[model samples]
Target: MDIIDNLNAVKRGKLSRRAFNRSLLAAGVGLFSAPLLPRKALAAEGDHPTFFTWGGFDIGELYQPYEAANGALPNFSIFGGTEEALTKMRGGFVVDAAHPCNVGLKRWVDSGLFQPVDTSRLANWGDVMPELVAMQGNDNGAGSPWMVPFDWGGTSITYRTDIFELEGEESWDMLWDERYAGRLGSLASGGDAWWCGAIKAGVDFKDIATDMAFEKIAAELRAQRPLIRVYTDDTTTLEQALASGEMAAAMTWNSSAVLLQSEEVPVKFAKPKEGQLTWVCGIMIHKDAPNLEKTYEMIDAMLSVETGKFMINDYGYGHSNLKAFDEFDEDTLKSLGLSKNPAAILDEGHFMIPQSQDWESRMNETFELVKAGF
Candidate 1:
C-alpha cells in the first residue's frame, strides 16, 4: 500500500503515524523535505475536500500528506477528459480541485471557475518546471499562476516490435501503413487524434488554427480510416490488443509502453521523426473551494517530489518537480524513452496548444464522419 493508505490505517487507530512515516522514508518516498503539518491544525476528521480529476489519479498515493494530517482521504470523482470535467462544473458539480492540462489552461482560466494559486503556499512551487508553469495565458500578466503542472507524457505509437517492422526511418506514417490495415487503432477523441493527425500531415502545430491546416488534418485522418481497426480513448484496451498480437500497433501514450513491458510484452514506444505529441496535466483550485486549506494542502502534496517520483517511475511520465529527476539516472530515463529534461520533449515534440471550443466541436464532428467511412 502507498502512504495515504497507511495514513488511513492510522486514522482508524489501526496504525501509528510515526511508524507509517518511518516506513515511507524507508521506501524512499520523500526525496525532498515536506514538513508535516501539526495534526491539531488540520481540518476536522470528517471534513474532506473533493477532487475532480482523471480516472487513474483518484488514489491514495497522490494525497498521502493530506490524509495523514486530516485523517481522511479527499472525496474523489473521475472525468474522462478535461472538457467533460469543465462542462460538469459549469453545470454545478462543485469540486475543490480539478485536473487539467496545458492545452486547457487558457479555457479553464477563462471559465472563471478557478482562482489563481498562491505559489508561496506550495512548498514545492519553486521546483516546478517553468516551461510547464508558464504555459500560454497561465501567467495572466498579473503575476498570478493559473495552473500547477504535475504530470507529463508523450502521445505516440506503441507497436509490437516482434510483429511490426518499419521499412524506413520511424515516423507517424506507420499508423497510416496499408500493411497494418484492420490491425491498428487510434484514440477516438479529436482533441488527441486531430493533433496527432496534424503532426502526421506535416502541419506545424502552431498553424493548427488555420483553415488550410484543418483541411490537411481532416484529409490525412480520412485517408487513415481504412487502416485502423478501432478507435478508442481507452489505453488499456489498446495495450491488451497489442500484447495479445491482435494489433500490430496503435496510437498510445508513454504509459502503455511501460505497462506492457512490465507484463513482459514485446513492445516499443516510437519517437517518431515527425515528433511525439507531448502534454502537461496539472491541478487547479475551484474559485469557491469549500475546504480551501485542505485543497491547498492537497495541491502541495501532489507537487511534492514524492508524488513526482511516483508519477515518473510508476506511471512512465515526467514529473513537474525538478528533484524527481535526481532520483533516476540519465540511462534509466532513456531506457524508458524519457528524457531527464522535460524541455527535450516540450521543445522538440508537438506540444498541444489551446484552440477555440468551436474548433474542437467541428473536429469531432468531422472525425465522426471519417470514422463512419465517409
Candidate 2:
C-alpha cells in the first residue's frame, strides 16, 4: 500500500502507527515529504477557528460536518495532555476551544479562561447525553454549560494476553506485580495515573483531596515507579512496545487495546476488579474565541452522529450524543467495553470527582516528585 493508504489504515485501526512509520522509511519518504500525503485542502490559516485538542482528535473524521459547511477543517493545535494544554492556555495562549475531561472541569472553569456555551447554538445539543452535560461544575447556573461533553472512556491496563501470564482475575495489582517489573509502561500524566493510583491505593474519590489520601496515592505510585520501564504520555510508544513484546503491559486508554486487537495482536483492555478510572472529556470555548460563530459549528459537528460512530467504532470511546449508540448493536458495544445505556458502564467504574485547582496542583507536583525517584 502507498503512504496515503497506510495513513488511512492507521486511522481506521487496520495498521499500527509504528508499522506505518516503518513503511514510510522503507519507501524513502523523508520528514519534509511526509506532509505531501494526500489530504483535503484546508483554508488559509486563521480563516477558520482553531481547535486545541489532544493529538488524535484533530483528524478529519471528527469534523466532517464542519468541513462540509466551511469547505475546510479548523486550524489545529495538539497537546500531549490536558494539563500541558491548560498550562499553555494560562500562559496567554489563545484558541477557539480546548478539550478537557470532567475531572478538570471545576479547575478549568475557575481559571476564568473559558466562557459558557450556549446549547441553543449547537444543532445536536438536544441529543447530547444529559449525564455528561450534568457533570460537576458544568452548569453555569444560566442554563448554559461551561463545557459541552464529547467523548467519555476508561483508563486501564492494556496487557498482552499471550505474553503476560495470569495468576488470578484481572486487577490493578497486575501493574504492580514484581514478576513484570521493568517490563511495564504507564502514561506520564498524573491526571490519569494518579487517579488510577487512587484506585490501587483504595482511596475513595470523594476524599481524594485530603492529606491522607494524597500520601496514600503517592505511596502507591512510588511503588509502581520502579516497576515501570517507561513513563510517557505518548500512546504510540506504549503500543509499539507491546506490539514488539518489549513490554508485557501498559496503562492505556481504550484506543490502544482496540488498535492492537485490530492488527490481530493478542491484547485485551482489562476490566480491573477494582474498577477502571472513568472520565468524560469535552470542549470549552475560549473566553476570547476569535471565531465565536465557527466555534459553535465545530462543537456541533463533533456532537454529530457521524463523529460519534467513528469515535465508538474506531477509537472505542463513548460519544455524548445518545443517538450515536444506535448504529452499534449490544454485542459490539459489549465487546468494546461500552453500553447503550452509558450509566451501565459509567456508574460501575470509579468516576473521577472534580477537585479544586489547589488540589490538582498539589497532586500533580507530588506525583512528579515520586516519578523522579524522590
Candidate 3:
C-alpha cells in the first residue's frame, strides 16, 4: 500500500466517506486501548498460524537471523488501523492472533476474536518487561492473553531546535499554538492527530464516546488546521521537513527523532507536560489462521533480546522487553528518549482510539472537517 509520505497528507480508499463510516460502524466501532485487564479470555487449540501487523514492522534484516535460527518466515498482512484488523477477525478473518497496541487489547479480547496466548510458548516470557505485561495481561493471568507486546514508542514533538526555541515544559498544546501557525506541523491522518488532540484537550482517548467531547476536540483541531503547513503520515518525510528547515514543529515517532538527532538534525523529543501519546505494536494470530507453528516462531523471533535491540536502537521504538533497553549503552537510551524509569512512561495514558463506530466516524469526520476547514 502506497501511503502518503509528504507534507500534503491524503488517505486513499475505494469507499466514500459515508461508506467508510458505515463500514466502521458495522464493525463494532470505537478506538483500541488497554483498560482494566480482563480476568479471562477464550482459548484455542492450535488452529490457525501466521501473524499480521503494522507496515514495515518486524520484517527486514533484523529478523533474518531469527528466521535462520528458527526456520521459515511467518505469513504476514498489514492493517491501517487496529479496529480494522479486529473487524476482519470478528467478521471471520482467519488467523490465530494479531498484533495490536496496549490500548486495543481489552476490546480485542472482549470481541472474542482471539485466545489467550500461552506464555509458556514464548520462551522470552519471563524476560519480558513488566510494564508491557501490566497492560497486556499474560496468557496465564487472563486465562488467555489477547496480545503479546513487541515494540513500543512515544508519539513526541519533533522540532528543529536550531530554528525553534522550545522554552518551558513542552507538550502537545504547542502543536496548536498560534504562535507557529504556518510553521507548525502534524500528521494529517486520524490516528496520531486524534491522539495528540485528545491529550491536549485533556480528554482520555480510551473513553472518547460523548458527542460533546468529540465536538470540543473538533473545535481544537479546526483551530489548528490553518496553522498546519504539512500533514504527512510519513515519519521520514516529517523528519526531513525539520532537517531541511521546511517546517519547525512536528509530531513524530520517538525513533524518527532519535535517528534524526543522531545524524545532527537539531531535534529533541520531549514528553510534553500533558503527557506524550504512546503506542505498542505486536504480532497477532488471526483466530483461524492457516500457518500455526510458523506464526509462533515469528513471535519468538520478535521477543528475542537481540531482535529487541534492533527494534530499539535501529527502529527507535521503546521495546516492551525491559531487557532491550539494558542492551543499550547509557547514551543510547537517553538519545532514544527512554526515561530511566520506563514503567512510569508506560503508566502514562496509552492512547486508544474509540471503538464506537459513531464516535470513531465523528473523529475521522472531525479531522476531515478540520482539514477542509469545516
Q: What's the TM-score of every candidate structure?
A: 0.87, 0.90, 0.78
Best by TM-score: 2
- lDDT tens digits by residue: candidate 2, 183-209: 999999898999999999999988998
Writing each residue's lDDT as its tens digit, candidate 3 over 1-374 gives 12122111212334333333223233433211111111111222233244556666525434554458545445556676777887887776776557777656656656755655667788778877765665633353645555677887788788877777666877777787777778878876776787678777778764566776787777788788888988877665676667667778888778667666655557788678888887766655555556666667667777887877867766667776777777878666777777556777667645454264455566777787788878
Q: Judge candidate 1 at residue 20 and give its lDDT.
A: 56
Over 1-374, each residue of candidate 1 has an lDDT whose tens digit, in order, gives 48777767766777654455446545644311122222332223355788888866766667777777767777787798888999999999898999988877777888889998888898888999998887777886779888888898889999999999898878899999999899999988887898999998999878987999989998999999999999998776787678678899999888878767755668899989888998888888899889888888888888888887777776788889989888999987886777777687678788899776777778778888988898
List where candidate 1 sits over 4 angstroms from the true fold. Answer: 1-45
Off by over 4 Å in 3: 1-49, 83-93, 136-142, 205-207, 348-358
Q: How many clashes in each structure?
A: 0, 0, 34
Q: Which ten residues in a row have the lowest lDDT in candidate 3?
A: 31-40
Give the Å shift of residue 292 in candidate 2. Answer: 1.1
- Which candidate should be chosen as best, given lDDT against the real structure? 2
Whole-model lDDT per candidate:
0.81, 0.86, 0.65
